[model samples]
Target: MRTYLDYNATAPLRPEARAAMIAAMDVVGNPSSVHAEGRAALGIVQTARARVAAAVGCQEAEVVFTSGATEAAGVLDGFGDVQVAPTAHDALWAHHRRSEKGASIYAMGVANSETGILSDLPKRDEAGWHAPEGTADFLMLDVTQALGRIPFAFSWSGADLAVCSAHKLGGPKGVGALILRRGLDVEPLSLGGGQEMGRRSGTENVIGIAGFGAAVEAAMRDLAEGQWQRVEKLRNILETSLEARANKTIFVGKAESRLPNTSCFITAGWKGETQVMQMDLAGFAISAGSACSSGKVRESRVLRAMGFDASQAASAVRVSLGPETTEDEVLRFVQAWLGKEEKFRARSAA
Candidate 1:
């Protein structure tokens, strides 16, 4: 009877990913070992690498596996002067360093997790878009939120480097990748046994990598089947139902291009955390904002960046859907939330 709607935080693990991980559990060899057993393990990692590369539209050699997107972002350190979008995820935003009027690297996310807003990358120019001459301008895109929910290709994304997480796309957690353009190099974050082509040196998470490959294949299949279009319809239905009943509600980023599964709405005088708790108790799982920022009583930076005042930013709740979400579940959630909104309105009027 419980409905799960917080997909932007983490997706339910795909069955293909689970099965692949279970199968990989039996493989007993270090990928760095030179023996037959080791070679077999190496083959698994290589195959997964190729699948991941194909999913992101990059060369296999360009992909370097990491613990997750946070570690992937660390690889970009010391690249150059760093500039970040205010709407970027905290992981990418934490790496920002002000540029001093010269060559600079831009780190921005393709999508905002809280508001589901999509950002257009800067156009390519002879001077590398926004940087000055005699400097190698680099663009780093955080594709963690955009990977499976929307169509993205690393080669066509106009990025010198891109990072994504496996768990965000139905793959196992703790496994992610950094995609670098061919012939571009970054200093190694970990130096050990010269693994990951010496870019990231450590024993690869063989089972997680296997699951990541299977999940990417399955996610692509779902995209090709137009499953997200159906999810978008469900999202619109949810929004319409809520808007019909609530008088003072605002849908964030309604006028912008967004991920089909995401809907972030705000109701004045009602805090997002309280609504999330009420929904959870009523058998629905939702979020006030990014899962990373959950439990913190701070306003959404993305909403504030979009010109929303403090109250609206703090009152926002995000309900993200998935292919498995049903129309009945969406309706039920709408009804439950509407009931709560009524009580809040009554108290405000009182």
Candidate 2:
């Protein structure tokens, strides 16, 4: 049986989400139309907007639906003076670009992929341009990796804007949200007949939105029920096993507060792609660093930014779990991995 473990890339559709999408597919009406049919579509879109808004603990009006997190981050360009975590998804990379020279550049640092490291912003700013006691428009958090697994509130975090992907939390792929604090002007990325409150204009994907809503509902329920505890247990088991068998392996991004499902590490003398391929051949799927560049042959920038040497950076791999992962799977992977390591060592000696 094939084991799918690459959750950081994308999650499988939840059953509730699939059912919701299937049901919504039957409703044939353009949300923008003023007729009864159009009104029905509009109602569906509004209901989804409310559900998604509630999921993130924000007002429905604050949530602007987008094609995905990439587009969501793109919207942040309208707001000048952007600050992002160096560990943020590539979508937020544009924050590095500013119209004027010497603009504030803040690259928040995280501890690890799974265990998020909180930035020492106050410490990092001891010299000048301090974020006033509790004010400033200098932050836009990319919550794509932190959402669902962590209890993050945009309002509480002091972020002016936040981006989250639905699929990361078992939602549909084609839908995401760009949440901006009140009064922050975000110019539209796509223009046409005004939709998404004149922010994103296009034909609405009612079915995908419905599924996205259901998935968010499920994730929220899971979070409330302490379901992450189980995943954390599996994660620890994997880490312990790695420690027992690998001598030079080291975990990366050990954040003080991170998404519980993520764990990135590097093993000396072994390339990440080779390990990933071997894992896949053994019926387990894992990522060689970020899945965003899974096919590309390059060292992980995140590791290099953290000061790892080129070889260690090239050796990093990410083993992200999901809500569906089981303890048995972790045990099996550990056992299989230990056996592989012994064989490789013997071959090296010969």
Quick one: best lDDT, which candidate? 1
The residue-by-residue lDDT of candidate 1 on 253-311, one tens digit each, is: 88999999999999966999899999999999999963454357568888888888888
TM-score of 2: 0.89
Clashing pairs counted in every model: 0, 13
CA error at residue 171 for candidate 1, angstroms: 0.9
Score each candidate by Cα lDDT: 0.87, 0.73
Q: What's the TM-score of each model vs. the native?
A: 0.96, 0.89
Looking at model 1, residue 206 earns an lDDT score of 95
Clash pairs, model 1 backbone: none
Where is model 2 more than 4 Å wrong at Cα?
80-83, 101-136, 347-350
* Candidate 1: stretches off by over 4 Å: 99-103, 131-136, 290-297
Model 2 misses residue 324 by how many Å?
1.1
* Alpha-carbon shift of residue 212 in model 2 (angstroms): 0.8
- Residue 162 in candidate 2, Cα distance off native in Å: 0.8
